[model samples]
Target: MGILERLSRLIRANLNDLIRRAEDPEKIIEQALEDMRAALREARMEVAEAMAELRKLEREQQSYAEQAAAWERKAAEALKAEREDLAREALKRKQQAQALAEGFAQQVAQQQALVNQLTTQLKALESKIQESEARKALLIARKKGVEAAETVRRFESKVDAHSAVEAFDEMERRIEAMEDKHKALAELDRNDIEKELERLDANRQVEEDLNRLKRELGLA
Candidate 1:
């Protein structure tokens, strides 16, 4: 309702509680800070207006007081001149002016109180805004850090390290099996070449022995 009441509500708000209850804490903090700043602006304006009103009241009280003093002096002069009716009229005027002055003085006191209250509320709201701004930054940063950590955790959870290692081991085993098969094929080819060479050597020795036998028979 009142500006001071609104400021008090804003100052009393629990930021941490709001953040905890919010689904998006960063957004909540930002909104809360914005609200505080808005309230602070309004509060400053209210305090300024209150102070202006207080000043106006003080000026009116002073003016009325001066009028009362002037009327009193006129009453004294009329009395010295022995004009009893004029003196009575001046005294009445002085009473009226004094009453007005006193009324303005009372108003000034009330306005001064209002101004003081508004000023205090304004200062409190400013301090709250400052604190909320600082906390907003810190809270946003912390929320980001928490989100980053959660992302990393989700990624880690999705990727199984044991499964990755097992896949690598399986691939290595397949490659080693291929290499063993190739080495066995090479060994078999070498054995076939050795057998062919031995067979050629045996055939050549048999031909030479037969020729020697034929030469011995040619002597007949």
Candidate 2:
């Protein structure tokens, strides 16, 4: 079988089973994509080469056709010259050129068929490569999301394992202790300034009373 045939077989293979059997999913997917791209490139090259071959065959067929026509003209000229032997030899050459032209025409037709087939196969391979690339993008995105989710879950588990609740409780205890300290500082029942104001009021009242008594005794 041809390379394209083998590549088509590989492209048609069951991906799910391959993925399941692969030791590394990422590597396998990458390799498969690369292989598909390589095959597509090779197939395109083959199509180009086949088309070139077909064109060469067509050119050969045209050459033989022109040669056959030239020989027929020579045979006619020989007959006009009344040379039967020369005309017969020219006719024989004409027939050989005709046969060669016919053979070339057949080969050109077959080559064209092969070229068309290869071109169609190349287009199909390109479509398949595009599909594989799209799938690879989606697969990579999904894997990244899964890995991100797993990382988040692992971080949460680690935090939980480290007892964040106990750390919060410790912080609460420290804040409560600080509040108690402020409460103790504010616990004085009476103020020294208030007691001093009370004593000054009492002395003012006694002085006023003594002055009134002196005025009443009429010492002035």
Candidate 3:
């Protein structure tokens, strides 16, 4: 599975159920916390890699755009010297450069989206890990309290054990609720129409640039 998928599964795992089934709650909680930390580290690496890719794409797009502008200037210079043939050739090069720049621009946008998504997931995972760590401490302490009470008195041990189980259940419910909230927010943030509009705007800008070049060369 993908890294995000794995992290999501870890975040959504039913810790209360795991504690109930495990022979040793403390060990189970500790192990679960460790697993979450490991996942968080992996997620950080993934986010970093994604951001790096985005930056590379942006740089490529900028380089191609600069090349396109330079070619346009060369075309204008050729036209000024009345070399129509050379001007046309330069314009062809300009078009080619513009096409490459546009392609790279699209890739940069997509990469940026991926980076944003990974960053959001990384933040959510970090929050989950922090919460889990706090819960783990509480869970282990409760387990120890129950064990100590058992040695002091059986009746007191039963009460403490029951309380610990109740606390675990409550924590599990809170976690599930938090996960649901994050899912809802993510869903709401997705807007296909906005992406479509952005693409249209990019195309419009390209057309405007071409028109401006035509006018500059007195070909409009």
Candidate 4:
């Protein structure tokens, strides 16, 4: 019946529609802002139309008042000129004009009230849209943060400590084998050196024995 009533219904319907969708928070906030903007646009148009209608009603009221005054003067002139029948007719017309003027006055008051209400609603809708836009930015930041955390989680899950340990164990075994081979080579070298020294010592001992024999067998 009125702009205020229609605005209330639209607001409720938008909220209910959002709830029914049950979507992501970011999406929900975005949709809510769009709905508010649409509602604001509609409210502006309604207020404009109501203001126009109110102005029209005021003009009609003024016209009716002027006609009533004119008819009243005509009625008085008829009475002064001794024409009761003409006076009665003019009086009836005056009353009718007065009644119509009063009706337009009432309509103007009602329309003005509606226009005021629609304007207030439009402002409120603008305020809500501003707040929702800020919230949407915050929501997008939070969603990005969540995505980054999920990526880190996936990377951590793919890394395996057991595999790293197995790789190190293989390298360690290869080093141990190399060390064992070096120790074996060093022991062989030491043995070879000791045998050569023993051979030299034996040769020196034999020479000494031959020299003693020659000395004992000598005539002079």
Ranking by lDDT: 4, 3, 2, 1
Which structure among the candidates has the greatest TM-score?
Answer: 1
Regions of model 1 farther than 4 Å from truth: 1-4, 8-23, 161-166, 172-220
Which is better, 2 or 3, measured by lDDT?
3
Off by over 4 Å in 4: 1-22, 80-82, 160-220
Order of models, best TM-score first:
1, 2, 4, 3
lDDT of 3 by residue, 1-220 (tens): 5566886677447565576676476766676777788888998898899999888988888998999999899989999999989989998998998999999999999998888888888888788878988788778888889898777798766777797888999999999999999998777666666788899999999999999999999999
Per-residue alpha-carbon lDDT of model 2 for 135-165, expressed as tens digits?
Answer: 9988988888999999999988888778677
Name the lDDT of candidate 1.
Answer: 0.83
TM-score list, all predictions: 0.69, 0.67, 0.63, 0.64
Clashes of 2: 0
> Candidate 3 — what's its lDDT?
0.84
Task: Report clash pairs, candidate 4.
Answer: none
Poorest lDDT segment (10 consecutive residues) of candidate 4: 1-10
